[model samples]
Target: MTDALAIATDLMPVLARHAAAADAGAAFPHDSVRALREAGLFGLLVPAEYGGMDGDLADLVDVAAVLAGGCLSTAMIWAMHCQQVDAVVRHAGERLRSDLLPRIAQEGYYLASVTTEPSKGGHLLTASSALLPEDDDLLVRRDAPIVTGGEHADGFLITMRAGPDAAPSDVSLVHLHRDQVEAQVVRDWNAMGMRGTRSVGMTLSGVAASHQVIGQPGGFRAIAVDSMIPAGHLAWSACWLGTARGALDAVVALIRSRHVPSSMSRDSELLRQRLARARIDIELAGGYLALVRDEVLRRRHSGQPLDDRSLQIRIDTVKVACSELTFSAVDRLVQLGGAMIGYQRDAAVPLERHFRDLRSASLNYSNDRLVGAIGTMTLLDGAGRLP
Candidate 1:
């Protein structure tokens, strides 16, 4: 196994042990996060020169899948953290990169993304909050409807209008340490699933050094297109697939451990068929994830533009497909396990939790919106035979 995957594998028991308590209390998985930090998994993507492993997308996929099998909430928080890390690595200026990347590598500084604004709904490409000049520093005050793991993050990567006069689409990404920002929790997070994420609403006011702006001002569009979308989608897909796989494993184990009644041989055969179907769905989702990962890696290595139409479609489709397919797989496993076993809160198998967590998969990004966007892109590609 790869070092990253091995590290995540070793932390599964710790994650599983705390998963139920964290979910019950809607608390952040502090122990799980501590274990990951101690294992140095936070530096899995940092460059080697910065004392990191410089792992690739495949490594992320493997690690997320393994981690999610233990606790989907913890795995998702890790994935989101990695997404912000990638942004900093790819777009941060020299000063910011030198200051933060090393600290992230050595100290495991957790980072969070602040993109969704109060009035903008789910739109992430534009920002209503503007960065105003304050002497030598840039000042920004913004309110987000939801900031995942906001309370636990050591730093934030915020999105804002490039300047007071800039258009909504002229956005910039700014980094601020927790000490640099005055933040207030505006709303508590009491969600149906993925409770450990603690994605609460917050208002933040911060002054960032001019050098903290990632890439050029008004250049966030490129950053999102090239790095953010791909990283977030792939990592989330892996997590969802892992959750479904974990549920399947749990149910299968429960079945094997119990003695089957000979009188119900026909029903037993049907259950086996359903399990086989669930396995096939999981396999198909995993296969597609691997294909997308390889394609993304190939493009990055070849220095090809990631914004190409064909690849963009594939990236978006992978997220939608994996989210739907994995949820379906878990749903099948839940039904196969039946109400007495799967629906029980304290059952041997944790299918209830898996079912609830996977329910958010489609709504997280809204598969309807993605499908519509994909359709528009497809219509725009008049020369498209196949991608």
Candidate 2:
């Protein structure tokens, strides 16, 4: 229920302080996370009864976009936590919900997901971990690469296969508690950008289970289709939208501050074209996000099921468009910027971080796979469409 701009204001200074260290040390943005929790973002997805915002996807988009304006890594980490809570609300049992909801809502506990597997090609399809019957608890081990928020997460929304190899395969989303899971920062993430997210590789070996099971075994796809697709797509789009917005602002400043300026009529036609086209691309993606989000709020969040194949196609298309557009805008900004923004956190630093972070959008295996799935569905009469 917080005003969007207020949230933006709360994060600006917090993002700047840790923005340097995050990239320098390749660490999680602990200060920015503290700021987000103080701003009540950790509870943004849980129910109001438990002192959470109980926000819709539109609210999520607003908060995420604002946070991305400040720090992309912090924003993306919160996005993962947002998805974790959303899944819990839909699929957790009463015992699980009752035990954890209040604790997280009040304490601002950090959360993340450990889903990408080594063999399954960096997505849900090939989960190597198995949740077997271990007397009263579940026993599971998993290997995940590029686990966002892994280094300091209190827990993870782990996706796993169930039963023995000969047993019927069941996929479940289980909460791997901190005590039971071992999340090591195995590799140094000296990337071109988004250093604060601490996206690292995780090796979970026979971890103990926690509350919140996202539906029955072998149901990862259902959890994704039902609870995650709309929300995650919109959230990442908003994150990149923030990046595009920052780039726009930076380029405008660049134009104004530089010598041989446009006002002197010395601005090259090429530069003007790049700026104008970047503007159009950003605005188009913004419009697409706004339009689809309204539909999501009016239909998807109104207790209406989001199962229509056509609607799913719209979701995939919009995601692909926004991601592609944002990346293009960043590229344009960098091309126009030349050598000025090559370094870290300064006038040029935000664009540098944004450029690197924007790449994560389409590179997400699940998101990319959806693009192809939607195309085949449109071309093949929805016979084997995977949404």
Q: Evaluated with lDDT, which candidate comes out highest?
A: 1
Which pairs of residues collide in candidate 1? Answer: none
Question: What TM-score, computed on C-alpha atoms, does each candidate reach?
Answer: 0.96, 0.89
Candidate 1 regions with alpha-carbon error over 4 angstroms: 259-267, 382-387
Q: On residues 161-181, what C-alpha lDDT tens digit does candidate 1 reach at each position?
A: 999999999999999999999
TM-score of 2: 0.89
Off by over 4 Å in 2: 165-169, 207-211, 257-268, 341-349, 366-368, 381-387
For model 1, what is the error of residue 34's alpha carbon versus the real structure, in angstroms, after optimal superposition?
Answer: 0.5
Per-residue lDDT, model 1, residue 368, is 86
